[model samples]
Target: MELGLAGRRALVTGAGKGIGRSTVQALCAAGVRVVAVSRTQADLDSLVSECSGVEPVCVDLADWEATERALSSVGPVDLLVNNAGVALLQPFLEVTKEAYDMSFDVNLRAVIQVSQIVAKSMIARGVPGAIVNVSSQASQRALANHGVYCSTKGALDMLTKVMALELGPHKIRVNAVNPTVVMTLMGKANWSDPQKAKVLLDRIPLGKFAEVENVVDAILFLLSDRSGMTTGSALPVEGGFLAT
Candidate 1:
């Protein structure tokens, strides 16, 4: 179970809270030096306080130009976890242009931009690295009232493949971990309503939502040398929700 992650430098976006935060803690526990990114300075400060060997960087991923500039100052990264994403659950007809744009900007475009920058550095340094994108089951299954979110995740899944192909020659692996509902702050905020929660839980064969640890475990595996041959793969940590 040695992840061989000690002394490794990792960058995880959306690491202030939720699954991203959990992943940052897990990596740090494995002895990785982590650069955590989020939009809120308070949340980033909280994360840095809770975890040792973690450097918090506050930047809005939705703003690609700003993100690129901010990341350039951080230098080379050994592992890049593209975990920042936003979900909007509304009827397709009601989804505004702004909402759709925001969803795409944060979930899909930002991933591409950050990964591009990090992968370039990895290649320049000749360091074999891994990029793990935190996607969702919505990428494969179309859920009611999640049209825009689904679209962005679907794009991310494909982008993972494209990145793998492009980075293969440089020995950089690109993959994605797709999870079903997880008990994170975001999950609680969106699914706290009894009716909505029930509707989501009923679809999972496991009869329960995933814990943040569940997804983090999968992501850590993919980021480790043990999964050296894994790339262009979308591994599902969905609690059999997709199976049902």
Candidate 2:
């Protein structure tokens, strides 16, 4: 599974932990230089200690000015992963403006902001690249108390399609990996309860949730030449949850 991605430079958002962290390690192992972006300095510091060739960038993706200033000078990136997101869960009736804005800010708006910066660099340099938007199964399926989160992800899916249509001509592939409740820090905090976990697990044909590595594997494939022909795809890493 050598994706022929060695020596490439990649920028990964939300690299503090979970799937983003794992993806950084995987890319580094494959010989790619990585710029790890996270809001937390401690997470970025810890990541650099474990992975070589990592350039850590700490910026809150939700901050328009800070995000632009930090990533606008990122130079040329052959690959980009828009994995940073926030899940402000609230029942549909209970959803507040604050939750709506925060979810949209980190989940969708920051994606557009970061991708525009990276994609523009790629276009200017005439470099063929890949962009992976870390969407969610909630994008296509309804989940209680996830009104705002689901809306952002659904918009992200459409955004991926539009990016492929527009950026494809420039040879920049854009796609999304829609994963079911991955056992990330957020996932464990929400689903560690047996009663809650079983409610969703039973719907999945595989009767389980995904692990960080499971989603990271999909991200790497989409970023690599292995998926050269793949663009505008919403690859599901949900272990049959959406199927059932």
Error of 1 at 181 (Å): 0.7
User: Candidate 1 residues 74-101, lDDT tens each?
Assistant: 9879999999988877898899999999
Candidate 1 Cα deviation (angstroms), residue 179: 0.6
| Top model number, TM-score | 2
Quote model 1's TM-score.
Answer: 0.97
Alpha-carbon lDDT of model 2: 0.94
Encode model 2's per-residue lDDT on 1-244: one tens digit a residue. 7788899999999999998999999999999999999999999999999997799999998899999899878877999999999988888999898889889999999999999999999999998999999999999999989888899999999999999999999999999999999998878998989998999988999888999999999999999989999999999999898887
Q: Tell me, what's the RMSD of every candidate? A: 1.1, 0.8
**What RMSD value applies to candidate 2?**
0.8
The count of residue-pair clashes in candidate 2 stands at 0
Of candidate 2, the 10-residue stretch with the lowest lDDT total is: 68-77
